[model samples]
Target: MAIVARGQADRGPPRDRCGDPDLDDARDCRRDRRAVVLPRGVARRRQAVDHRRRVAGRRGADAARRAGDGEPAQGAHPDGRAVRRRERHLLHRDGGQPGHAADHRDRRHPRRDPRRAGHGHPGPARALVGRCRHRGPRGASRMTADDLVWILPLIPAVAALAMLAARGRATLVWLDLLASLGVLTLALVIAGEVPSRPIAAGPLRADSLAIPFLLLIGFLAVATSIYSNGWVRHEVAHGGMKASSLRYYHALVQAFIATMLVTVLADNLGILWTAMEGTTITSAVLVGFHGDRRGLEAAWKYIIVTTIGISFGLFGTILIYAAAAHAHGAISDAMSWSEINTIASRLDPGIVRIGFIFVMVGYGTKAGLAPMHMWLPDAHSQAPTPVSALLSGAS
Candidate 1:
């Protein structure tokens, strides 16, 4: 794009001034003026070389355009290593581009669940996930966040069963506290591992949205367990609660926590609904554990209202499932949140809209939003202090 002009004013336009030393001097160029007009200060021979290169560039550009964008023309580099490097860069930019993907394949085995990836194959992020796994002791693979997903719901569940089989109040209390501590520990560990790849176990997954809620539940469980021990003892001493109620109370508390944990971790829509129902059941009994008229009334109201609302959620779940089945022919995991989301654009909009409305209302009622929160006030009022905290903070 450089332009050079002759000193004479009569010169029509600027001429190229290529500094090729092999070219004839200005006097020789003047002598050959009859063969071809050579402008002053220009190398006549280099102009021929430049013209030839222009044609080659146009052809090379045509071939390289057949490759990927942002890449140099093919054969632009002399060395084989440089050519390979250019090809690798182009491949990364192309995202494998159908037939061209083999070169970019990861050497490591795939770790991600294909259902979550919208297909039965690793995605561009496969390499990133592999790198995140890093190295473990003696070349053993480190456990990912997904590996611990099943343990979260199990800790409180097992402790609840242990409490039910145990005799003493102190033993049940100890089990309850220990279970809460265990859940908190695991939540912390899993939380640290969560990054670009989400944690997933069959029917269960904890993505970014669920991690904070899970952490809150775990932390609150430990705090409430400590508070419940003294509160339960005081209630019994004051004759406000029966001594026998302590064991049942601790057992129900753990069950309630287990249900909530499951609810938070569930990736399948059906599993989520089931966990919500589990919460309603376990927490309802705990709400009325006092065995009084007011507590009984609150428990009934809470269960009834929540159940009716959840029925809407069930209908919505069914509608969405049917829509997904119709579109994908049931081979896909339509009930799974991840799988459904991957193909969300393909579902019928009208059905999806209506189903999501039902889902919102149902889950919203569970969340205690206005107009659906009629039972919340009474239930929180009648439940024990620790149970009230759970309903307010974790439930």
Candidate 2:
């Protein structure tokens, strides 16, 4: 009975080495309840912590990369406490983490992404940017010595026109005088003793007659340019010419000078005749510049009479060519004045005399000599004073 009691006592309490049976059972129940409840909550919390840690790690890696590359790290979340805690733990384990203040200073503020900032179409701005890049910097205006050289011829022309246009402006008259002086200087330099090359296949000569004519023309042009300024001004003041008519007048004067220069310099009779005809056309326009009935009628008569006379001159040219063909057997020799003059005595003097008659009549009409003087008085009288001066003096 005693052995049986001892065995029963040893197996008596199914407690965990404690003397209280109820307490032991309560403890085991509590443990079992805890085991059932705590595991799921702890597992969920751990998963959240792990996710936060992973995100924090990614952010830290990105920040590190950005810092190394000298670019701003943006878009990191501030409200993620778990991630912050994990980051703190990691930083503390390594060293101290950079402070929020320092990180804020180091990091740039979030900017509007360039891709999302604007509402306009993107293409034009891009094209503008490309053009800006291509053009680089603006450059200064460039002028050279050769450009200055061109101004020599241009100044006289400009001054002559300006003088005519300014009309009553006394200041411009002085300016015109200065421009003429410049032209004289240029002409002196160009008209050196160096002989001009022959234009046609004949001996080249610069006769006293041609040189004197050239010098006279130049001197007369200078005087006329100065005289025109005052004359046009008087005409304008007196209501004889309008501003627009003055412009045509000045332009025609320059054209006349250029044409006459060509005529005097021409070695070939054909070229001389062409230049003279051009002068006639240009001068006729000047004669009619006023557009009045008298001016128009004068221009008409001048043109008709000159054309008829020049037609005879053309016939004479053709006859000369015919005679040259009979003598020299070359058509080109007929066109050269020097060659014709050299062979004039050998050729039929009667035909030569007739040709001279036609030539003299044609050019003389333009030269304002004799019967052609009928149209001249009307044209000159009707034209502005400056134009009249030019017609009478310069021509």
Query: Of the candidates shown, which would achieve the greatest lDDT relative to the real structure?
Result: 1
> What pairs collide in candidate 2?
none
**What are the Cα lDDT values of the candidates?**
0.78, 0.60
Per-residue lDDT tens digits for candidate 2, residues 1-395, read 11111112223334555555666466555544442323555667767899999999989976676557445444233322223333333333424343332233212223323332222212222222222222335785575332332343466567656656575445555665576566555444334432443222222234434555556556766787778877777778888777556555666676676566556656677777787788788878888877789889988988888887777777777767677666766787777777777776678777777877887777777777787667777778776555566567535
lDDT of 1 by residue, 1-395 (tens): 33342334443332346634434455544543434434543655566778999999977866666556565434322211223333445444535442232333332235643333422245645333435444456868766667789988899988888887898878988999999999999998888877667888888888888889989999889999999889988999998799876778898899999999999999888889999989989989988989899999999999999998889888888889988877777745888888888888899999999999998888878878888999998999999999999988754
TM-score, one value per model: 0.63, 0.51
Q: Compare the candidates by TM-score and give the number of the best one.
A: 1
Worst 10 residues of 2 by lDDT: 1-10
Could you tell me the lDDT of residue 179 within candidate 1? 95
What C-alpha lDDT, on a 0 to 100 scale, does residue 370 get in candidate 1?
81
**Candidate 2 ranges beyond 4 A from true positions:** 1-206, 393-395
